[model samples]
Target: MPELLIDIPSTFVERIERLAAEENESLEDMAMLLLRRGYDFAVTRPEVEPDRSQRPGARSDARLDWWREARFGLFIHWGLYSVPAGVWKGRDWPGIAEWLMYRAEIPVQEYEKLAAQFNPVKFDAKAWVSLAKRAGQKYLVITSKHHDGFCLFDSAVTDYDMVDATPFKRDVLKELAEACAAQGIKLGFYYSQTQDWHHPDGDGNDWDFDPAEKDFAGYIEDYVKPHVRELLTNYGPIGIIWFDTPKGISEEQSRSLLALCNELQPDCLVCGRLGNALGDYATAGDNRIPEEVLDLDWETPATINDSWSYKINDHNWKSSVDLIRKLVDIVSKGGNYLLNVGPTGEGVIPQPNVERLEAMGRWLEVNGEAVYGTQPGPIQGRADLRTTSKEGVIYLHVFDWPADGQIRVEGVAAQGARLLAGGAALPVEVSSGALVISVPEEAPDEAATVIALR
Candidate 1:
């Protein structure tokens, strides 16, 4: 199917204006609300079939299968803010790098000045992809464009891009895209849909619900659309469009943006933050993991520390064990876990983040079978423990060890059982009620032991 150019019809605009007047909301706010609804409609309607020609190497089923199997991914929050590298002047900034301008209340002009000094001399895209792979991550989502409004790629749409405006003068997105393709890691772009503080039209003071901005619709047509086109077309194959901040967009605008993305990159997955259901997957905000699988494909994105971008004084980092457990829990609940890493100003990932990822990787080396290529178990019970299955093989991830060497697994119909990490076969005896298995005196893994059922 060809790309459908989304132009808000005049009648729909009139209805929205009337609704806004009735609700005492600005026209922009009403439009945004409507767009949100439309997005939900698009996501839920299922009227639009996926374009098969655009999705390369796999059918829709295969892509969905691969996505379901890939329960873990690495999210990098790096950009011009990385040049500040978590510090303002000689003082350590405790906030995320991306929000440095907002936290410091530095005007956009002053923040753009950092572009002159934003040269990532040691920035290696291959190394970044390699790190993610080593961490046992199947996909990589980087900020192609953040709320700060700087484009990582050479955008024909704007002069305020990495290759054109910054000292780095490199197309980071192109490099990363190539690296991801080479490494067989799915590449995703994090594009902020609404707040582009740098762009004149993106000025939050006007368009956001707080203050009315003039000609907001014009901004979307001229600036946002062109940049999005650049992202979808210039990049070889973007796996996902991770949109954020749908503040002032109309429902029609949101639908148009999503439709355009699908038209350009038909197989590409879109996130829930597009202010509507125009996305393939739902996104749970920072550090939020839903207790139940959201009845839709979803991913929980969380930072190692409080900040998405590197912060000099933010020593708070999640332990390797905790991170691994989070991954296991998320997968067992049938969701993807996206762990974030904020790189320092000099373009190097902080040592702490690297160490944590490496430690998780070490654990993954042994118990990864329980993780990758597995689906959620049928039985959702078992406190502190979860199960995943593949090829009729059930993996019981024991979060809490039993005092005696026995753990009761209800509804396990498998005839044989073994330890995945240790490879030690266990005696499985079925009682009148449930199947009981004798675990080893010591657990195979300190965090979680995988009991493989055959």
Candidate 2:
């Protein structure tokens, strides 16, 4: 026996081992055979490779105009982990629900059993999209697949999907796609490309799979590429492909995935986590906002509560005021806000989550112009305040309340000033080389108030 190490999931080695055992051959011979077989599964390849010989992670910059303006979106993390809801074997798990498999180190045999009881009768795709629309989210990005290796959509590459393995046979992705289209919302898919825990050839689950079983090339050819193709072809007009937690993939492999996406859908936006920093835009640290402005295109994936996925013990919900301020801060710093909501196993967005979203939507109803289609404020590094400008007009976001009726804006000479929520003009004057506006006795909005200046 020879040691065969690979960069792919541990399970891929098991697959090659099984192949070797079935043929009564050595591991080295099986490795070669696996690579040969992988080289041949070119079904996902386009008949004619487009003339897109651009560098790895290359993308069409002009195609993301809509994405640039879509300052807010909803990120949903739903899968079998919701079934466990963070409780495994009657013991409470602390982290996010989606990481149940990896964190708990549960074997694939035992973890797959979760599908038997997975039923989301309350899951309504239409309602989900409708809520997003009302919440002022320009798009919706849901977890098509998470690290647990469970597929929420119907994947031909594997039968361990919502339509096949789970009791709920409905395809969640299909309904979401249809609903998003009907509601005029852009839809994107979040996939855990390198961290699938379910498929025998998928990555992660080192406890169940040996080192030799991890075949990066084999998994890429047999599973990853095909899954991307299925999502691209089966779903109509995907806005973006969000690949997360890049660990096992190489730079060349990452580039190949990017090229494949560019080939299939030239205009599709790819997130930076696809590995090797090869993506259309940048992804920020989880649930965090950048204090200073970023020169490159970036986005912050935030949570309505503390956890990205459903957690029964996690009640640290961000207030409507807090979320509004956070969104303003992100957009002010030249970044998009990707807020998350984790539905329960029963398929319902927590009531608290819905209420907070609706509140933000209500605020947007009055102050959308201040957010949408705006650029970074002329002034930078204002913690208590932010500015977004379009054309000659600038909107000042007052995150804190002034106990007095007077407010001052530095580094700006205001030609005029008015309340954004209402069309009321406020007296403005430049004093001490700063723009000052006269506000009311109290803050107009509990979250933040926007003032327009010309």
Best by TM-score: 2
Q: Can you write out model 2's per-residue Cα lDDT over 297-397, one digit (the tens) per residue?
A: 67788898877888888899989999999999889877889999999999999999999999999999998998997888887786668888888888989
TM-score of 1: 0.83
Write down the worst ten-residue block by lDDT for model 2: 46-55
Which pairs clash in model 2? 9-203, 12-213, 13-212, 13-213, 13-214, 14-213
C-alpha lDDT values of all predictions:
0.77, 0.84
Q: Per-prediction TM-score, please?
A: 0.83, 0.86
lDDT of 2 at 417: 88
Output the lDDT of residue 257, model 2: 91
Best by lDDT: 2
Model 1, which residues run further than 4 Å from truth? 1-63, 89-95, 203-210
Residue 378 lDDT (model 1): 61
